[model samples]
Target chain A: MREIILSFPKQFKIGFKAAKGIKVLGNFKKLLICGMGGSALPGEVLKIWLKEKEIKLPVEIHRNYSLPFNVDKKTLTIIISYSGNTEETLSAFKKARREKLKLVAITSGGNLLKICKRSKVPLVVVPKSYPPRLALGFLFSSLMKVLTNSKIIRGISREILSLESKIKLKKLEKEGKNLAKKLKQKILLIYAPEKICVLAKIWKINFNETSKVPSFYNCFPELNHNEIVGFESFGKNFHTILFIDKSQNPKILKREILTAKILKEKAVESSFVFLKGKGVLPKIFSNVILGNWVSYYLALEHKKDPLEEKLIAEFKKKMKV
Target chain B: MREIILSFPKQFKIGFKAAKGIKVLGNFKKLLICGMGGSALPGEVLKIWLKEKEIKLPVEIHRNYSLPFNVDKKTLTIIISYSGNTEETLSAFKKARREKLKLVAITSGGNLLKICKRSKVPLVVVPKSYPPRLALGFLFSSLMKVLTNSKIIRGISREILSLESKIKLKKLEKEGKNLAKKLKQKILLIYAPEKICVLAKIWKINFNETSKVPSFYNCFPELNHNEIVGFESFGKNFHTILFIDKSQNPKILKREILTAKILKEKAVESSFVFLKGKGVLPKIFSNVILGNWVSYYLALEHKKDPLEEKLIAEFKKKMKV
Candidate 1:
């Protein structure tokens, strides 16, 4: 697990190269990225990054089986399944192919890859050793490359190249360890600015999968509207982590501060993890690594295997039968 | 709160009339529904209903400030704010107006009303007595009327008219009370099939605001991929409630049964609430009303004021500063 985390930065380079020759020819007006669980995550990350950069294309992330009803020829559908066998993604892929919609795919070696080859759908096959969650870097960068190659968006090669140097793993790991200690025996709640709220979801998933704990998340401004009230009469073992980005609106910044203060008054505990690093990719991936570390160390604290996801495997097997 | 729930069905009739003469002119390719908290919920409900009916137009629900980056001339932007003053929706309304995009507004009365009138954007003003969350029937039906008037979708007038008769409130309230007693003093986790998962979210928010308890939710197929694993070492007082619809894919139905069995094996408690009612509106609204009663009765059990939201008021006051 430690080695996997250490080697994570290399995924950007490899993922970029893997998609070098793959491209779709279309004047796509929008995007529908379909996947499930960890495979669905890169679309989320990409949506946030694209929003931050003010890309005008609407990117809808779908995690369910079959295609979202709105999908049309103008909508470019990108199917992602790390195992190349995710049932829902394959279902969507089949539907998209039947509709003759412009399509692309990202996977390792599995049914998704095989079908993509049969259909001549553009694809990028990444390494498949790690669990889908741990293989985020590969999935995300490959999807980014697909967008760039298809001329759906401008190239971020320079940003991708610098991502490895920007990540300070040891510092983030130490901080994550400290966070895990504070979060020990505590149900986790995560919040981030709305546009970048996907980071909070990613953190919650890490805590849930790696640490084997029930963690939940929602974005700020919106959470302030409803979820904040849930803490008014807090009588549970809950700890909140706020991912603050200094680049966000000052009003949101103030709301975060006041939200934390109100939670404190209600006897709910919260800690802030400022998103630190230059550029959007650095800021996001740095925090992503930080969360990975927190979950890793917490797994050790709980005497759990960080790499084990027996329940998912079991459910999938049952699903097949 | 109980009275609000009781009169909820009437909102459908009243809301249908609210937009009787209102309409928009455009060749909309998609939809961007901007809102927050309770105000945002109708869009979620509408999306699920639309998907079930196989409406091909894409509806994107936005909860944050300003507009989603993808908003363009071809997108019909519907801004909803029960108070007519929600900050985020107002911001989106302003952006849509500035961009000269086709726009509509739904509200009881607030700055949103003033702005829409000033700009000549089509608007529907429903009765403003209930809290936004409590006014789901009004918000959702009015939005539907707007779509109907614009010819974006066919009228479900018959379905909306029959909704009240479909709800057996006395029977559902008893069930809600029993469920509330079971959920007492436990953190709530909700799951529904992916398309209708918004009901799970609505239920979670109801539990949070009405009962002042922390709650979380996720959809099936996706949760099966990642979140089910979190229960592997469950160490908290978490109670999961599954909202199952018999109309869904048999594969999903099998997954739900298997998921419940596995949760039991892991010693995590779970219960199933089948979504029972004929037609889409009845099925959705019945379960929605059931959740409301559970939260209302749970509030009584906790001795919390279901109608009181002092924290939200305080947050709003502070945000104004």
Candidate 2:
């Protein structure tokens, strides 16, 4: 797990290389990303990134067994599965094929890879070793390369390489440990602005899978409209971590600050973590890397194996399709 | 609150009348509904209803302030705010207007109505009095009528009217009271199939607002991929409500049953609420109405007023925008 965390930058380079030779099919009206669990997280992050970049093309993230009704020939459907064996993604891939939508596959080698090979769909294969959740860098970079190559968005290869060189993992680890101590034995309620909402989700999933804790997230403005009210009855059982980006709309930032005040009044402990980075991708990945360290420290505090997903294995065993 | 619950059916009739005379602009390439909180719930319900009826036009629900970048003149944007004063909806309405997207407004009366009136946009005015959360019937019916009148979807006026006549609120209240008794003092984790995921979200929000509880929801297939694993460390602190419909895909149904079995093994108490009704709308409404009663009863158990949203009021006062 530690190696994977440190190797994130390297994964991006490898992902870019793997994405090479894959033909760009431009003029697509829409893009659909199909995956579930960790595999789906990258697509979600990319969706937000695209929105922030002001990319005009519509992108839909599908986590279900069937594709959306409107997915047609003009739609570019990207199927992602770290193990290439996720039932839901395979099901969606089959449906996408039947619909004859333009298809691409990202996997480390499983049934999905075979299907892509047999069907002549372009494939980007990442090296397999880590759990799917730990492979975000590879999965996300591959998807980003596909989007850039297709002219759906501009390339960020140079920026990614620079970010890799600039990131200081030791510093992140120290900060994560400090925060994890404060968050120990408390449920986490993560909040972020709309543009970085996926980052909050990543934090929640990290805590859920790594620390084996029940953590949840809600985005700003939207939460201000509804979930903020529910905090009135909250007690000390939860601690909120607000991921604040300097670029957030002033109104949204005010809402987040006021929301923290409200939660404090309700006796819920909360703190703000200002995200640092210039570009959207840098800011998102910076927080993503820091979240990994926080969850890792949390796992240490809980005395649990950060890499083990026994329950997930049990679930897959029971799942027939 | 009791009056509001019983008046659900009557609201549909009034809403249908209110929606009349609102001209529907046809030939829209896509549909976008912009609203937040209660107002947004109806759009979500309508999206599912449209999917079940196989309406091919792509419908996207936007809860944020800015319009999607893809919203061109051919996109039909429906801005709904029950009070017509929700800041986010107003923000989105202004953006949609500037983009010259086909615009429609549904509201009782507030800034949104004024904007629509000044802009010469068609408006559907439902009656005022109840809180927006309690105004789902009116909002949903209004949106449904717009789709029907626009030739985007077939009219369900007769089916809705029949449902209004056949619904037995007294029986639903009794059932809701029984369920609420079991659910009191416990956190709720609502689950439903992909087709009815929005219903699960509604239940969570209803619990959050009315019962003053910290409730959350996830849909099948998706939950099976990640969250189902989180249940392994589950204690007796939470209860799961699986909203099951017989008409759901067989594979999804099996996953739901297995999920329930796994939860039971983990000592997480769960019960299946088999959705009753032949049509999608009827089944969804049945669960929605029942959820209202359940939350109301739960509020009574918590010694709180279901209608009093002092915290939300405080939030609005603090929100500058």
Docking class of 2: medium
- Supply DockQ values for each candidate: 0.64, 0.57
Best by DockQ: 1
How far does residue A236 in candidate 2 sit from its true spot (Å)?
1.2
Reference interface contacts recovered per candidate: 0.79, 0.55
The reply for model 1, stretches above 4 Å from the true place, is A98-100, A115-121, A232-236, B98-101, B114-121, B232-236
Error of 1 at B109 (Å): 2.3
Estimated TM-score for each candidate: 0.95, 0.95
Cα lDDT tens digits for candidate 2, A7-48 = 776777787778876755857888889988889988888777
CA-based DockQ, model 1: 0.64
For candidate 1, write residues B30-111 as lDDT tens digits.
Answer: 8999999998899888877877788767788888777777778899999999998887788888888888889899999989
How far off is each candidate at the interface, as Cα RMSD in Å? 2.1, 2.2
